[model samples]
Target chain A: MLRIFIAITDNEPGVLDRLASTFRRRGFNIHSLTVSPTLDPAVSRFTLVTDLDDKAARAAKSFLERLVNIHSVADVTGTTPLLRDTVLLRVAATGATQAGLFQIANLFQAEVLDVGADSMVLAGSGSPERIEAFMTALRPYGLLEMGRTGAVAMQRCAAAASLETAVSF
Target chain B: MERPPQPPESASASASARAELPGAQIIWRCLEREGVDVVFGYPGGTILPTYDAMVDAKVRHVLARHEQGATHMADGYARASGRTGVVIATSGPGATNLVTGLATAMMDSVPLVAITGQVPSPLLGTDAFQEVDVTGVTIPITKHNYLVRDPRDIAPALREAFALARSGRPGPVLVDITKDAQTRAAVFDWEAAAPRRHLRHVPPPVPDDLLAKAAAMIQGSRRPLILAGHGITLSGAHRALAAFAEKAGIPVAATLLGLDAFPPGHPLFLGFMGMHGSPWTNLAIQEADLLIALGMRFDDRVTGDPATFAPHARKIHVEIDATEVGKNIPVDLALLGDLKDVLDRLEPRTPSLDTGAWLKDLDGMKALFDAPTWPRVRKGEGMSPVDVLKELQAQAPGAVMVSDVGQHQMWEAQVMRHQRPRTLITSGGLGTMGFALPAAIGAKIACPDAEVWAVAGDGGIQMNSQELMTLTQEGLKIGIAVLNNFNLGMVRQWQTHFYGDRRSASTLTISPDFPMLARAYGLRGALARTPGEAAAAIREARAADASTLIEFQVDPEASVYPLIPPGARIQDMIHEPPSQEAPC
Candidate 1:
């Protein structure tokens, strides 16, 4: 099963390497990982997707949390967290296919970032499933180039809580 | 010299009492504050500044022949003294040499702090001479590591490194300081530079529900066995383990590294268990109904094949590290906390069980399977490794034996009697060779009053034999026992069993005379070619006030018996050949 883990770690040099090394050393298969600065400048948040069973996932969480730089690690897969992946695609399109492409983009709520002489760049952000569907819908136009920010996740919160209070180490 | 005006006592007083010093001086000052009196290291270009500052530092520096030996010494020091061991080295190869030692410490959960000097900040990542990403290379091996480009971060980094090294599930931590960082002066405030309070990884409190579950399991178990591990020694829970075993009437079986955790001759002690472990103890584990695993990760060597390991047993893993609980063999219940604390809380709730029949059965198996009469030596053959270890055990009863990896290590584990925790220091986890001689130096340095002996095989002793000079230079009274069997005994044994005896590179076609080599280093040396001669040499080495090396020429074909073939079940153990004369 795929498990999503949200980790808050110290925003220091080599923190990313350490985090990645932890997963690699334990032979944990990471399907996707997204890391960015959090509201607290001193800390960074990571959204990691790994393929593991329930027990192995718990073991991975325990192992990652043991890193001194990591403040906390939470398995948010069961929480139905809002997961998003931003993808940019440049498709081979001519003026003849522009209208249809715009319509297809509109249907999926994707934005046309640029319109080239013979191609268009489209950007989309949504759940991985939606992203996959959007890519399938646009594949007929001939994708020239593509880039994606692997799935980042956030819990649907009922109230605001500080990072310190949200997780008990 | 005129005394400086004293600051008035106030909340800010400590903050104001700061000393302006270079990063290298700050390193020593922090170590002093951490109560580290000695460090094992070698000097190099990048680390020259620190070496120069050592003249003024109160800490004694033991110069090592190689960086690897230095790290092992620090590791041995940590294991013997129950304190964080410290090692310092230069960048690139120097730092890389510490890798094996660091991994060894990491595997056994030994607390160590490694300080390495990096290329100057400007030259970092530019492929400067002797420049390597030490921290990056050590990331997977170290519990945590720091690379300080700024002089101000030195004190805090060292403080944090020491704290983390000795914290929960202790392991090695590294601090790499750039040359410029070590040279530049900075304000050092011991109080202000203290590691954050939350840096400590405190294990959660033992849950009442888990204790209740464990207690219920114990009450229901008819043939429970306590699998005492290194954690008992690490957590100082030997007493608790014994108390719980006596209270519950469970036989205690120790892992290889866990040999000294429980006294060897205790009635409840079932002997060490794992690959090359005693047959009866392995059989007991296979037959037991409950296995209480404490402070030890179930390494592959211990559980031959996890699928067939303790088939009928419901394991209760009591560990400090949460990751180890279900990493190897799945456990029915996991009690997470310090072993001593967990055992103390669970002891009262544990109902005393009547396991008289179970104990009697185990005793019968032990008597039947463990009885091995010594084979009388033929006139021309050399002594056996067992005979040497037995004589050494009898002569140096209270000595701390630091063993190198391979056949001698296993034989020492099997033949020697360990009465106290931390007495037998060996490379259990990583199984690194050449660990004994240098590690024994570290152990002797850590426990000056205790007798320390380094026991290594012919192949292993040659790995770090140069450290004999360091042993003599430091004037440490360590006994070096080299079982010169003329081959890499363990590998040869494997070839003899599974590889059609195709020795390949296992045989040492040429090797040094270890006794002469020891003498060349200005140390006492002795050679023994028979059991009686080996006993006399061991007695003489014990009686000598100076460090002595005794070379015992043992049978090259002698193999560690009761061996479990790789991936084989414990019950499928291959005992010593029935036609051959038995080992003592």
Candidate 2:
């Protein structure tokens, strides 16, 4: 059961220590985590993917409920999302294999964002599940290089920032 | 400057000057607000200003021999008085020392407030001198923690710390404040207002539907039993448990920490159950048709084989922490709330004492109380732990007995009959080794006149044995009776049972010549080998001449028995008497 909640926060020294601390102290396991400052100069968002049981998950919610300054925690699993993510992957692109790779990308609605000799980059953004499924199909062609930007989800209908954030994170 | 003659408004001026202070002062003000009169602490470079300010603020500071002992004292204090214990220490080593104590408090649900002095603000990340991330070190152990970087957040941090410690599901809280914040002088308007918190609340009363469901279960059971845990005591509902037990005519067993929740001699009371528990209590719990577990988290020792334990019985668990409700051993009817409040509301609605068949079965088990199988006293040597505890009980009769981990702990738990709630203190969850001495110090602080005793093993005392100095410095007259078995009694028992007596690090030599240690701390000390010797030493300690320690030389192999080895079937137990060897 992997559930991710991305939190954006002010880049104070102890901020991440405190934010990540809530998870560590409560015995929650992190499956994957990515942290870096985005467009905001003084703020960084952490894409925290957690492997938590139902009770642990609820406890995680309660723990985060009282955090000091988290800007917002977005449960970006499923929603009409606006924020984008990039996974730069260069796979074997020999002439014979290139058509197969192109077909694979086209089938998954992925655009051929970049292509090079013996390699290609597939660019797409919707949800993590979409990117993951494409990555699984591409594995057979041998992914030569790989990079992934976690789901940087933004809510729809209004300014994405209008969604209530728990704290300055 | 043309002011009316300010008629010595110095005091008001002082109060007003402190009205807008930040971080460190914020914590201090919170302490003042919490009515903290005494603090146990040791200052290093990191915590100097807080120490200095505490002195000026008129908070009595007793320096501890070690940070570990300081927290234990606070744990003892909380157990004794139903108030949170406060311990202050410098960062790094100071914060690390508090981990085990905090873990122990969490396990037992004791309320504790630990304030650590951090390194200066600028040097926080470069592995600065005396700077260890105190919050990081204690993250897993504390109920919650705050790192105070901003001065304005101080008072609120403290308010939250204390509230978190003693609130729903009480545990330890640490407030790690930086040195710069401590020394910063600001307009210190400090109010320890915890009104900001909205999410945390005492669980509501057990619903009527739930109580009726539980009552129905009680009505249906043929051989029903009630097992009370520290939750009953924490909720201040021991009386409620008794009322329910008596009204329903059910037999009750207790966890180690649940001692005295039901009057020890009450007809409905069955002795404690676990690895070291009496045979009959274990047997009785096994035969129950319905089991009601209130406030107790069934630790592994209590439930030997989780799948097989109490198989025939339908279990009901009432716990405040949802984490504990179903973590181990399933509960048929699980209600989460404060024990006392839940039981009080449900008592009247429960059926009047009509389970005659069930009551009679437990009453028959109670007859086994007279025949305790253990190493008998070999006349005129020194005081047995049981006898010494009994004499201590006779004098302070209602005093809280705090114990260190070991054979002595089991003996005190068995012998000292506590007639009141929150009277017997032991590290049940963590089983921390050197808990008794400092805990007794805290216990004495909790109740100045209530006779407090530290019943410990020779090995258990040495772990934080340095607390003897803290006791003398604090000017507390606490009675200490060491059941000196010359080895770590519990560890030695394991070697005997499984490893064929191949002793390892369990045997401790160069024993703390306790009398010498006592005198070094400006206190009195004595050695006892016989029951009479124990009585005399206890009598002298009770005189309030000074804090005293009595070192008892007992047979080294005198193991605590009627042992139920872990994972073994209920009836398969070692009922052997301890080896009666010569005292060292």
Candidate 3:
């Protein structure tokens, strides 16, 4: 079973390698990993998904936590956390399938970002489950190219958000 | 300014005024401040700056024939004197060569500081000559490591490296500095930059409640066994361990590296406990109900299969490193602190236990399943490895024995009698070959007043035989014993027991005249075919002021018995073929 682990670490040379190598060395196969700068400029955040067993997962967590530069590691797996993956798909857009493609995109709440003579580029971002279904729906449209941002996640917060505070694309 | 009529510029003032010195000089200054009087290393391209700086430093450097030997020598020095060993080498191959030594030190928790000079910062990742990611290479093998890009960071990094190395749960640490960093000048302030006060590792105080819990466990134990390890020696807690054992009337068994931490002939001493440990020691551990594991990680060799290791024991793991408390074996109580401090606190509060029946049972087991013994041999019969080790120990009673891995290592552990702590230095973890000869040189250098012996198997001695030149160059009076069985005896033994006795490639056909080989290094070498000859050869080496190598042509068929087959339980040990009374 896949599990998601989040780590906050110092943005230093070889720190990423140290994190990735910890998983590799422990034989923990990472399925998806997304890394980016956190709000704290000095620290970077990593969201990793692996299929390690319970024992191996605990060992890996402890092992990664022991790295000198790592600040904290949290296993957000099965925590009902908010997990997202973004995908940009460039697919053929002809008269026969254009309507059906647009219908599928609408159903998944995907946006048609670019439209050309015979092709259209669609952008979608949502939970990993929604993204997987969206990708499958777009696969039959003679897909030419695609790019995906690996799963990034965070624990659900209880704070309420106003219209001005919430931003959506 | 003239109000004080200051005493004519003291050395401290002079040091502050003369702050501008090469980075390499700072390295030496830091090492000197850390009380490193001797260093074992070999110089190369990237490390030339440090070697050049050594001219002004007061520290003595022993030039090893190989980098690996240098690391092992430093390790041996640490194990012998309880001081952190220092080794210096260059980048690329020079740095990589120290990997085995670093790993060996890592496995055995030896306090070692390895300094490697890297290619200039500009050429770091450009694949320049003698450029390698020394820090990256040594990350897993070292307790901590630093890659010095700026010259100013040298002193602090070195200081930190030494502190981390010699601190809690001591292990090897590496400091890799760029050649430019070492060659460039940096402002060195001894007091302000190198804060010696902040570097000490003050072990955390043991909690009273935890000690009470541990005490109660000991009080409840009827068959208590103390599994002492290197931590006892590292903490200088041998006396405390012995006192506690006596107070509680618990029998103590030392781990492979822990062999010398307790007196050899004490009634409570049950001998070394592990794979090739005495049959009685293994049985005692298996039968004991309470195991007080001190400073040992319960390595696979000791535990065999974690599931079945000491199946009846309720463990109290007293370790300095918290990560190791329950990493291998479950514990009923964990008293995490410095072994000496913990044992000291426990000793006074602990009441004498009535373990008379347990002790009697252990004594019975000891006599029933004693260490393997060989029949009295006539001349022309090759010497047994145990006999060779016993003869060597008999001759050099106070000598520190540094043994390489394999059959001879086990024999030395089982047969040699140790009266002091830090006396038996070997690669217990990792089990690296070629460790003995170089480590002996280091141990001898550390304690020049004491004799040092390098006990190695024929296959193992050849792994670092080139270090004989280093021994000769240093003019160390170390005795080297090569237990030659004309084969890799341990592997051959495995084949004999598990693989239908097909001795595939384990047998050595091409051979060297070991004594003649020693003579090539300008040292005396001798060959001993019998036990009497082995004794005389050792005596000859002891008499000589220079180093000597005595190659004992040992019995090829002889093997270490009471073996724990790989993946087998500790209780399921295979006894010797000739003495198969009960296979218990």
Candidate 4:
């Protein structure tokens, strides 16, 4: 099963390397990872997607929390969190398929980022499942290139106080 | 990056007004504040500034022949004294040499702080002369690490490194400071650089309900066994372990690293448990109704095949590291806290249970399956390793015995009895060879009044034997025992048993005369060919004022018995051959 983990860590020089190395050293395969600054400048937030069973996911959470710079780790899998993934797709499109591609993009609420003679670039952001469906819908148009920003997550409700207090420590 | 402003009232006026010192001086000041009286290290170009400041520093420095030896010395010091050991080295190869030692400490959870000097800040990523990313290389091995480019970060980094090294599940931590950082002068305030109070993870109080549940299980168990581990020694929970065991009449089995945690001669003590453990102990584990694992992870060596390990037992795991709870074997209950604290709380709630029948059954198995009687002695044969170890144990029962990895190590664990904690120090987790010589030096330095001995196999002793000069120079009166079996005895034994008797390259056909090697290092040396000779050599070495080495030419074909083949169930142990020949 795929698991999602959100980790808050101190913004130190090698925090990213440490986190990534922790996964590698423990033989945990990370499917995707995205790291960015949190609201607090001194801390960074990491969203990691890995394939793990329930027990292993818990073990991974415990391991991550053991790192000195890591403030908190939450396994948000199956928690109905606001998970989002962004993707930029460059599809091969001539004059004949431009209108159809735009119509399909409109249905998924994707934005057209660039238009060229032989290809058009579209940007989309949504749940991971929705993004997968969007990519499948545009597959017939010949995807010239694609870039994904993995996944980022947050609790649906206003439970920011827990993370805020954890990071301040 | 600009330096952050220090809190105004963080330090007293006197502390704040102290003269500014170079970052190198700040390092020593921090060590002094941390109550470190000695450090094991070697000097190099990158770390020259720190070495120069040692003239004014109060800390005594012991120059090591190699960086790797220094780290092991520090590790041994920590294990023997229950204090955080410190090691310092230069960059590049010097830093890399500490890798094995760091990994060894990490595996066994020894408390160590390693300080390494890196290339100047600007030359860090440029791969300047003798430059390497020490922190990056050590990230996976260290509990925590720092790369300080600013002079002001030195004190805080050292303080935090020391704190983290000794806190929670203790392990080695590293601090890699750039040469410029060490050379630059900075204002040093001990109070201002104090580690944050919240940095330490305070384990939550053991849940009362869980404690009650564990107690109920203990009270209900008829065949309960306690698996004591190194954590008992680390947390000073030996008394608690004894109390808990005696209260319920439980038999205790210890892991290899946990040999000394429980007194060996105690009636309730079942000899060491694991691959090479006594057959009775392993069989009891297999037959137990309940297993209370205290302060010990269920290493694979202990549980040969997890699927068939303790097939009938319900296990309760008490560990300080949460990751170790279910990492190896699933447990019925996991109480996360220091072993001493958990044992203290659980003891009060525990109900005394009758285990008389179980104890009697285990004793029968022990008498039947323990060390078998050897055949009649042959006239011209060499000494057996077990006999040598037994003689040493009889002669110096209280001396700290540090054994190197291999056959002699297992034999030492088997024959020598330990009565107190911190008496038997060996490389258990990492199984690193050549750990005994230097680690014994460290142990002796930490406990100057105590007798220390390093026991190693012929192959293992040669790995770090150069440290004998360090012993002679430092005037440390330590005994060195070499079980010279003329081969890597453990590997040869495995070949004899598992690999169809293909001797391969395990034989040490060409090796140094260890006694002569010691003599060359300005120490007394002797060679013993028979059991009586071995005893006399040990006696003479013990009485000598200077360091001494005794090489016992042991039986090359003799193997450690009651061995569990890799991945084999505990019941399938290969015992000693019937009517084994005894040495002269």
Candidate 5:
């Protein structure tokens, strides 16, 4: 099973290296790790995916939090969360197949970014399931090359309780 | 005409408070304020500024031959004196050399503060000469670490480092200060910056329910056993633990590091337990109905297999660190607090129980497995390591024994009759070789009035034998006993049993003349070939005015008896000589 960890850390030169090396040290291979600047430029968010069991996930979460500059580590492995990815798919194309490719692209709500003599590039962004379906459809038309941005996730908020008074412990 | 600068009425009192000094000087001021009088370090280019600052500082700095030795010495000082030991080293290799020692301290939970010099902030990631990420390298091993790129942060970082090293479950902390920061000046206000005591982890209030639960277990236990650990000494709870043992009528079994925490001569003492521990102690643990663990983790050595360990015992762990409660072995209950503080609450609530049958059962096992007396060997015959240790124990009953990890260490732990806590200092958790020689130096420095002995196996003695030069330079009165078995004694023992006596690399075919090496370091040296000679050599070493070394030719095939082979049950002990007794 795949486990996803979202970590917030200070934007520093060695922070990424430190974070990446931590996974390696624990003998967990990072399947897909993506880092991007957050709303606050001083901080960055990292989405890391690894194949780990619940026990290893707990141990890794504790270790990641122990890193010097890591602000927080949340294991979003089993939450009703939003998952997304972006992919650029290039498939062999011609007038004979262009109409069919466009139909498939439209079906997945993808855009045909460019058209070459022999191939065309389709840019797609959606949930992991949608991306997988889009890629699977394009493969039948003779896919040339593909590039994907690994998933980013955020947990859905549950319904709020009564706010007349604060909850007491 | 330089009439000693008049003690300015107000200035003298607050000189350090208002002094604008270089960051390096401020570092020393913080150490001095923390009541640190000694430091062990090896100076290099990056850390030269702090070394230069030391000329005017009041702290005594012992120059270690290697950075590893410096860390071990600092560790020894901490364990012996119950204070945070300080160490300093330069960047890159100098800082890296302290890794082994840092890991050792981390394993044993010793309090140590290590200061390393880093490259200038501008050159940090450029792969500049002698630049390495000391903070990143030590993060996993250290309880906490800091990379101080700014001079203004130096004083506060050092203060925090000291507090972190000493608070809660104490362990090593590293502070990497940049070279540019060290040379820069900062106003070090000692009064304004108060060593961050407020930030220290406050010991939690004892839980009444947990105390009641433990007290109930004690009352209901038929064969109660108390497993004391180094935490008793670290928390100054030896007295409380001993009182609890006596009040509850419980027998106490010590881990290797727990030796002397409870007086070894006490009637309820069951000796140390672990991989190389006594068979009777292990048996007692197996038979115990209630095992009260204080300030000690259930390490793999002590617990052969966590699932099978203490199968009959209801274990209660009293530890400061919550993670250690169920780390290796499951505990029936956990009381998380400082051992001393928890004991203070639990001792009064604990009801004394009548456990005479349990005591009798344990005594019978002990008597059955007691070390049997062997026929005396003559002048030309090689002495057994156990016999040599027995003689040493008889001669120096109260001396502090610092042992290097190996067969001799086990022999010393098994044979020595320790009477008090903090008297037997050895690398228990890490089982570090080459620790004894330098650690004894630090121990002697910490306790000048006490007799200190560095007991090492032939393989271990050679690891840090260079520290003998440090001993001579300091003129410390210490004794060193080298159990010379001409092989890696412990590994050889395992090979003889498990590997069909292949021997392989266990034997040390050619080695240095240890006594001659001792003489080269300006110490009295002697060689003992037989039991009488070994005893005489020990006497001579003890009587010397300066530090001395005694090398004993121990029998090569003499293995630690009543061994529990790896992955074997605690009860399945292979008694000595293989043929003398069957596996119990």
Candidate 6:
């Protein structure tokens, strides 16, 4: 199985909805998915995960590499230096559910930004894995709204060199 | 024809000073000095002047359809006669076309001199015309290359190129002459260029102690194997190897490129070893206690899993290239020098020991693997490549047999026998297809009295097979046979084993009926469907004494027997169970 980041058209209101529908139609199961807007006004990033085996993973990569409206797709399952994402969730004021959600948020180092008469909103920024795990823990609570940002990765300091440092082809 | 006038003395000092010794005039002088009796080439923009020159020189020029064909022809000729084979091509695309041929020669160490015309020097880097950096492109593939910077350099460069190509570890060399240089008058001074500046050799013997140690290892080892590669061919050490192996009672395995090292019918021969090699050979390799490899790189294809390859044996490697010594597999002992020189020194002091027990063990392995009598070879509807070579072998006996890359070549090497050095030519290292046909033409040109045959597979046959036209026009009497399986059998075999029986793209583009194509090129043709018919066609082709193409269409999916698939230890070979083992 491989984890990949995808760049796709972010303008359409239901782009993520359509993508998930396609996955279900192909009997494909995605382990994780997060979407977010970028500095580019017209595009969005999608960090996705799949449970495919090696051969199937290679075949799937080849297929996705040829899709239209796709800016790029990069697999960063291992050796990716740096990555971060953000998630914000609002939940109703329920006793046991609220207490459990607060404990999970505390575990992930999330900050409780607001407490309203009927709900509370929690915000956190960390790795996509951390964000997704937190979201799964909070799903049972009567969640009012939830939003998560896609993972954006950057090269780590000093170790981020490329082949150009060697020979000039 | 009146001889062209000599260049003025002033032009000698000025060097690049242009004069009017028409390109034709220069060609005549050049061919005369090089003793060039035959050339394989096609006419093009930059070579027009030189072709005109051939008319006046009375030299034979065979017009090949492709530049690659010309290069292979030259390679074949050199292998045939031990003389430098010379090929010609025009500039730009013509020069680029010879890349594969040059690489093929480089890998096998064939002696070839390729002369290519260049655009005028003024337009070289301007993108003015059909201009490629021929020198740069061929740098990795040639023993040496020269771009004539001045008209005066032509004679010396030509002499040097030819000399370098045939000396030491022979290889392809290129002499790129600018259009202006070919046109400009240069003093005709063949005598001025000496071979001293061109000779390549290593003086003196290797340390005597090295041979003594190797001798000790040979005597003590309970089981020993001799692995000889093309280095034996390059060093002209087949006789020494035979002497050494026979005296020591060592079973020998020839890498695909090392095909003719031991006479195929020798009692101690184990045939080819490595990926796609014989099960018997692989099993013997796995079981050997000690191994001495001569002039062969243990590539991944040859040593499926290097760590486990012949795991039971300690290795001793004798090779010319230092980088290859331990690149793939490590060696317990190393001797670097000319193989012939090293072997000759070892012959006298070699200790006599009967590895009877070792031989018995190897025989046991041979029996366990080489016993496959299936795919019953009969005079059915297809030609037997082995029989075709056999018939041709009977006629020529020692007429150098050269093969292009593919399964047919492996079959020919396994079945045919060569009694002399430089008699069996092949592109061993590069394994380039489309080598044999032109090479045979070159061979015939170099050794006119010797019979030459190009044994090729179907896919390889058509790569540069268009040279049949050249054969027809020159009326060169060479034997030609194609093992047409309608597919690239070697890779297809790999696909079967590694890719789960997925034939994939190994199938051919279907072929033009070989007989019609041969006749179209003004040559007699025949087809062999069975072993008997194959032999008969070969006899008939030799009798006709003209260019011929005999096609042998066999079962497309017939797996070459005795294969040791990649990544599998040789000991895991799937050999036939008894009832079919033949004595080596």
Q: Which residue pairs in candidate 4 have backbone atoms (N, alpha carbon, C) closer than 3 angstroms, thus clashing?
A: none
CAPRI docking class of candidate 6: incorrect
Poorly placed runs, candidate 4 (over 4 Å):
A158-162, B1-16, B197-200, B370-380, B577-584
The CA root-mean-square deviation of candidate 4, after full C-alpha superposition on the true structure, stands at 2.5
Ranking by TM-score: 4, 1, 3, 5, 2, 6
- Where model 3 places Cα greater than 4 Å from the true spot, the runs are A37-40, A76-84, A90-92, A95-111, A116-119, A133-146, A153-169, B1-19, B190-206, B349-351, B370-380, B578-584
lDDT of 4 at B366: 74
Cα RMSD of predicted structure 6: 14.8
Worst 10 residues of 4 chain B by lDDT: B371-380
**Which portions of model 5 miss their true places by more than 4 Å?**
A4-23, A31-49, A62-156, A159-169, B1-20, B189-206, B371-381, B578-584
In model 6, which runs have C-alpha deviations exceeding 4 angstroms?
A1-169, B1-36, B56-59, B188-204, B370-399, B574-584
**Candidates' DockQ values?**
0.52, 0.18, 0.10, 0.58, 0.12, 0.01
Candidate 3 residue lDDT tens string, A106-139: 9999999988889999999999899889988888
* Model 2 stretches astray by more than 4 angstroms: A1-29, A33-86, A94-103, A127-129, A149-169, B1-19, B186-195, B368-385, B394-396, B577-584
lDDT of each: 0.88, 0.76, 0.84, 0.89, 0.83, 0.72
Candidate of highest TM-score: 4
lDDT of 6 by residue, B1-584 (tens): 11234554655664454344554465567667777777777767776767667777766777788898888887787766766777889889999999998998887777788888888777777875778888777766777677774556677677777777766567888888878777766555566644443332322456889888888888778889999888887777888999989988898998866776778778888777775566667777888889999988897768887878988898888876544567678888888777888888887877877888988887776675443432223333345444555666776777778888777776666566666666778776788888888888888888778777888888888888688988888888888888888889778766765677677889996788988888999988898877777778878887896878888777565454555556666665543212222211
- Candidate 1 is scored at a TM of 0.95
Record all residue pairs in model 6 with backbone atoms less than 3 Å apart, i.e. clashing: B73-B438, B77-B442, B77-B443, B381-B529, B382-B529, B382-B530
Q: For model 2, how does the per-residue alpha-carbon lDDT over A127-168 read when each residue is reduced to its tens digit? A: 677778888989989888887776555567653554433342
Chain B alone, candidate 2, TM-score of 0.91
Query: A44 in model 3: Cα distance from truth in Å?
Result: 3.4
Q: What pairs collide in candidate 3? A: none
Candidate 5 clashes: the total is 0
Which regions of candidate 1 are displaced past 4 Å? A158-164, A167-169, B1-17, B197-200, B370-380, B577-584
Model 3 lDDT per residue over B1-584, tens place:
01121223443565566657788888999889989999999999988999998999999999999999999999999988889999999899999999999999998989999999899887879999978888888888887788887766788778878877887788999999989889877667666554342122334788999999999988888999999998999889999999999988989998998999999989899888877777788889989999999999999899888888888899999988766767788889988789999999999888799999999998788667543452122222467777788788778888788899998888888788888998899999899989999898899989999888899988999999999999888878888999999999899888877887788989987789999999999999999998789888888889988989998998877778768888788777776643322221
Candidate 6 global lDDT = 0.72
Q: What does candidate 5's lDDT look like per residue over B112-138, in tens digits?
A: 999999998779889999988888888
What CAPRI-style quality would you assign to candidate 4?
medium
Candidate 6, A1-169: lDDT as tens digits: 5555443433433355545544564577877676666556456666677777654554445334322223444555655647787888897765546677678779989988887777889998898778878877777776789876656564456644531122111
Predicted structure 1: lDDT? 0.88
